[model samples]
Target: MSTTLHIVLAAALISIGGCGDDTTPTDTGIADTGAADSSPTDTGPTDSGSGDTGDAMVPYVPDWSCLGSVTTGTPTAATADVTATFTDFGASGPAVGASIQYCPWDDIPCASPTDTGTTDSMGMVTLTVPTDPDPYWGFVVVELTETRRHEYYTSVPVVNDATPSALILNDAAINVIALVLAETQDYDANGVIGLGALDCAGRVASGMRIELTTGAGTAFYATEDGTFSTSLTETSTAGAWGVLNAVPGDFTATAFLGADSTPIGTINFRVKAGEVAGLFMFPTPDGAAYTP
Candidate 1:
């Protein structure tokens, strides 16, 4: 079987497509990528403007009070112990330093007062009050200063009631002597004659007596304790004895047995030159040579 051959040839066709279309939109929110926006906005630190803000500091205030007591009879035969305490009002902790000043209530110049002291957690101070024959009154003032404020405390009126039994001779012109007499003797003795007797009897007399003398030959006499104290306004000389003007000279004080002038004993002493004089005397032994 014979078949007819037919050949058909088609040319290769090539078509070029355009670039792909871009549909995704570009970013407009970025500052550099777009124009600046005009909307108003809040920034910087947050501000609520409320009352419970910042730090609160406390203010300082001072309030003080004083307490005091007195103990009678101290250093002197009659003296008193004065104590005072200074405290702060509403103070929970210990107080700072404090000062206390005391003076005679009647004294205007403030003679001798105690010094200031610091409180030892407890505000307290004590001082000695001298007793005087004349009534004395005084006050205690305490002061304190802190970083915040100043405070002051004052005590009520204080008085010294003690009385001194021993006489104080401060005068330079006066000579002082103390004597304790024996039970057998009735009078207190002093002067040179009293001193001589004190060596024998051991005990003297206690008391004071005054007398006047002309410094003449007339011998001055003391009866009680064999003490003789006499003041001479002018100087004079009697026989072999010579007495200087206003010169206090002590002589052997002699006590007689009775009005008969029998010599009992002599107390020896020297007079102090001045306005005042003191002497002590003692009892003498029997049969002792009595020379007037």
Candidate 2:
């Protein structure tokens, strides 16, 4: 997604992916990626590093050979049932009457909608889709309008016969979308966080620490209690991991297995203010964000 947002996602209100001036990226990787500098603070987690990003990263190429694909949730028959629930972190409780839809996982922006529905009084909806289930993965994308005063957006990777217990806001995720300071109003009013870790099979990975070799001073990592911290403990997760207060710019990032210096995955992502750019982590040695 060199400049085009490898994991680029565009919204009517916010363009979640892509860089306006990012030059084309030639190659990507690292060997001696130094430790990122971080300071424990109440605002969020921070990781400092000694690299500077200039060239755009190459389009995301999944090295899926070595990294396997998750097989458990694959749909076997045509037209499967997917259960979706929407909840808010603050006082609203559930996202009632919220709009929900089914989109192929490969399309990050959820540009295409195959099936759609509206959440009920309980803040839940079940949508059935055709048998073709993205051929690889299926996702339930949620959009909030007037429900929270600000437009809200979020997606959860799901499968046939499975229902997401809580696609709840404030669920603590590593990726956050904020308004790029300008004339644009910040749309992320609910502080919705999206988890972006996937196992070799493209499933959400358990836990790890993501360090920016040349990025923001602090990041927001989601805790089980549904709060954010910049501490080492928050760098780890049984769910999703993320960071914030990152200046809108290009930077190199490395993922390590909790306190271990060995690099598991290396990625270059761009975070523009007012955009929901994502730096999804994939297993290394084969997949470069896209597992082999």
- Which candidate achieves the best lDDT against the true structure? 2
Q: lDDT tens string, model 2, 53-84?
A: 12322222222233222122334566656565
Error of 2 at 142 (Å): 1.8
Compared with the true structure, all predictions reach lDDT values of 0.22, 0.36
The C-alpha TM-scores of every prediction are: 0.24, 0.47
For residue 41, give model 1's deviation from the true position in Å. Answer: 73
lDDT tens per residue, model 1, 1-292: 1010000000000000000001110111100111122221110001001011122211111100000111111222245544433333224223446555555533333456543344455554555555444223343333455321121111111223211000111211011111111112111221111111111111111121112222111222222211222332110110001111223443333433232343333333233322212222222233131121
Task: Output the TM-score of candidate 1.
Answer: 0.24
User: Which one wins on TM-score?
Assistant: 2
Provide C-alpha RMSD values for all models, in order.
53.0, 14.9
TM-score, model 2 to reference: 0.47
Considering summed lDDT, which 10 consecutive residues are worst modelled in model 1? 7-16
Looking at model 2, residue 133 earns an lDDT score of 48
Superposition error at 44 for model 2 (Å): 22
